[model samples]
Target: MKQLIIAEKPSVARDIASVLGATQKSKNYIEGKNVIVTWALGHLLGLKMPEDYNKDWTTWEMNTLPMIPKKTGIKPLPKTRPQLKAISQLANRADVSEAVIATDAGREGELVARWILQYVKFKKPVKRLWISSQTDKAIKDGFKNLKPSKMYDDLYYSAIARAESDWLVGLNVTRALTVKYKDSLSAGRVQTPTLAMVRRQEEKQETFKPENYFTLDLTYQGLSGKLQLKNPRQYKERQELEKLIKQVEGTPIKVVDINEKTKKEGAPLPYDLTEMQREANARYQYSAKKTLSIIQRLYETHKIVTYPRTDSKYLTTDLKQTMKDRLQAVTVMDSDRVKGIIRNGGTVLQKSVFQDKKVTDHHGLIPTEQAPRLEKLDNEELKIYRLIVERFLGLFEEPFVSTNQTIKAEVKGYIFLFRQSKVETYGWKQEKETTQKRVDFKIGQVIPANFVINKELTTPPASLNEGTLLGQMEKHNLGTPATRAEIIEKLISSELMERSNSKLSVTPKGKQLLTLVNPSLVTPELTQKWEISLEKIAQGQLNYQAFIKEIEQETTALVKEIKMSEDNYVDHSLTTKVCPDCGEKLREKNTRDGKIYVCSSEGCSYRRRKDPKLSNRRCSQCKKKMEILENKNGAYFKCKNCNITEKLDPKGKKNKKMTKHETNRLMKKVNQEEEQESPLALALKAAMEKK
Candidate 1:
């Protein structure tokens, strides 16, 4: 009898099938003598929407403030029904004995498989294949030591609880606010608090008042020192600073104290998903979502890196045995550095890098045994891969040893401090060169000195960039590593926040959202507690049902607050342009594509691009660029000057005239492509096609 193995994605299924000797491939699955491998496209099913439970909930109304269903159910996602149906057929096959869950090893991944199993009513015994990397050896070893499905029941329960609770709180609050405020506003357990944090920072920026101050800089024999004060670091009055500088201008400086110490700094921990995201945002100005997408490709498509959604930065103790192989896998990127480390017996495990207790769900992001072809990775992928490789190598390098020296000097009864660091060993910081100049000083020695007074003004807090916002999210425990990027992107898509000059700021809509949202929901405290409870549920320390019951109670209170609140919401984005369909004012909205005008009327679903996207296709008559516009018929290019229109074919080529049937088919294909293809996904697909 053959065992049915279900994977998370088709690409992943192919990898697993290859390792399991399931070479006989079909459209939906691969089969061998003893195994059949099927796959899910991310998630085959999701929690049912409110309208599925009650028809009355279809329309938004204040009366249905809190639409809580008696039981939350799962439904097959429309786009992926074919894959789900195929998996169901394979599960019930006569030759198939038991099923294996080969999805990604995480809470959501477990939910994906469990929902399908529940839907199919598969009564056969089930096992799970849990492995971090997609390398052949890891897959083979995972199957050989498959664990019973019951082992992860708590994790699955936790996933269900999280999904249900989010639906209850997010949907009810979002509906209540939208109906009462007459705007498309949204709030969530994680997203609302995150937006509130940005709004709060913006408030600080708006209310800040700068104060002028002065400081004295002391220079003595090629050494620099700043005047240290007792209370405020800067002198508030210019006259006070001038007097101090005059007193110490020609005074001989006496070194009162000298302290020297040797310090050893260990290498930084390896890349967890959050840390990697933070670094990528700071260095490359990549959005959290962008970095996650790139790293995910490195994990899922290239199979060069391990899991990308991990929270742990430490490897399990058992992974120590495979360290050499992982190091060797990345040698192609920097053969000299990796080979040198391996030759010097530097692959020995360290407690800082290998601790079984610290690893949860998956180990830190590291290269797999699959050696990467540098050419296969695009520019952004190469940047991320290089980060992971450098971090991994740092684990085996020696500690950075330095001699730190601090000197305290007194001139005219005022204390000044000078500090210097001399590097004794570069260690893991091999990429950087130390430029510190060594200087010797003895206590009670007088030195020639000069002083200069400099004026400065205090500045308001800087706006939160993607990197800093991610740091705040990590600090508040707002969301998991896997979901934080999605939350940020959601806030942007919902028009609550925006990105400008590489900094995150609360939009006018977002500022109003904070004032209108429930007071408890605006702070991180509520969500932090929820995240802690969810973690407890995953660890079996808390009952999932009880935790969800608390969330339901909170949802009821939040909805009631919104219903009773007397606050008013103003449509700041409303424009003078009126919607042609409903005679309502059009609201200007900023989108990634560009600004667009959306109808302000809640009941109207009218919107159009404020500025039409220019296409390369030129007007045959005018020889000028044409504007691309879409209608019920599909996308077509029209020339503003020549008043000529042409239909766009499926391949984006222009045709003078096309049949109605062809236009409809092209529109359907275009809709599907827009719905399913992200820029990174399309790029990866194109790259794979090239291969």
Candidate 2:
């Protein structure tokens, strides 16, 4: 009898199958003498929706809220039902005896396999394949040392609790707000607190009052020092500051004291997913989601990096033996730097990096032993790969050493301080030395002073960009490293917040959402508590059922609060134009594509593109761009500049325009095609059909 192995994705399944000699490939699985490999498309089964429990709960009504089922059931996700069936059939095969869970080695990964196993009612013994990297050696090592699946049952339980709790709170509260406010407002355990942080920063920006301040700088024989003050850095009255500057101007300054100290800074910790996202955003202005995607590609497609969704920044002790191979794999990218480390007796295995106790489900993001093909990588992949590789190499280098010097001078009794740093050793920084002018001073030596006063204004707190927001989320324990990016994206997609100039700002809808959402839901404390509870569940310290019970009680209270609250939500985007289908006023909403007019009625699902589609055709009279528009008559080109209109040819020329009916029919056909092709679209369509 062959052992069945299940992977999280088709690409991963192929990798495992290749390593296990399962080359006989079929449409759904790969077969070999001793193993049969199948795969799950992320999650093939999820918690049953509200309607699945009770049909009346499907409608969004104030009274029907807090739809907490006594026993939550699992259902096959409609789009992936075929794959689920394939796995089930393979599980029941006479030749397959025991199963191996080769899905991702994390809490969520455990859930993916456990849900499938439970749904298939696979009573055979189960084992788990846990490894950090996708390298062939790692895969072989993992299978050789497979552990009993029961060891990770607590992790599976925690995953279930997290998913069910989120559904309960998010769906119930979202339905409550949407029903009362008549707008598509969504709130979640992690996302609401995240939005609250952004809203708080915006509030600080709105209420900020800038104040002017002045500083007195004294220059003497190429030596410069700034006047230091005790309490207030601001000089509100310019007259008083001017008197002080005048008194200290052109006076002889005496060097009071000088202090010199040598300092050493060790290399920074390796990249956790959050830190990686933060650094990518700071350097390339890539969104957190964008950075995660790039690194995930580096991990899955390139097979160069380890897991990208790790929270730890330290490697396990076992990885010390593989450091040389990992470094050698990345030598192609920076041969000089990597080879130098190798030639100089290899890496030092710093205690900061190789701490097994600090590692969780997986070690830090590091390069695998697999050498990368530089030409195969795109620009973004190359960047992320270089980032991880450079960080790995830094672990071997010595600490950065420097000498800091501080000098204090007395100019007419007004004290001034100057500081400078000189690098004693570049170490891991690898900085080039440059000549800089130096000032030598002795105690009690007097020099002529040149004084200048500079005026500055106090600045408000900077807005939160993806980097800063990720930092905030990490600090608050708002979400795991894997889920934080999705939370930020959800805020943007829900129209509660917007990204501009690389900073996140609250929209009018976001501001209103904060006011309308329950106060408890809008604070980080709620998520922090939930995360702590979830962590305990994963560790087998707390019962997930009890925690879920508490969530149900909380959800009931939150919905009741919304029902009684007098606060109102006004749709600022509402317009006078009525929806063509529902006869309700259309709301002009800004989207990434452009502005769109959506029906204001909650039950109506009618929307149209409000922005005119620009066409290559130019106006004959004005020789400017023309807008392609259609009406009941047919397709035509119009120039807003000169009020010129021209009939488009109906013969479907190379530059032919489609009539309104044809355009809509074509869009419908395209959407239908996409629905057929995309799993997510199919799932959404299935849900809509059920409704």
Which candidate has the highest TM-score of all?
1
lDDT string, candidate 2, 353-472, tens digits: 878889989889999999998987878889988888888888888888888889898876778887777888888887856635677778988856567777788899999999999999
| Alpha-carbon runs more than 4 Å astray in model 1 | 248-251, 590-594, 602-606, 618-625, 629-691
TM-score of each: 0.91, 0.90
| Candidate 1 TM-score, true structure as reference | 0.91
Query: Which window of ten consecutive residues has the lowest lDDT sum in model 1?
Result: 678-687
Clashing pairs in 2: none
- Candidate 1, 549-600: lDDT as tens digits: 8998999999999999999999888888989999989989777789989887
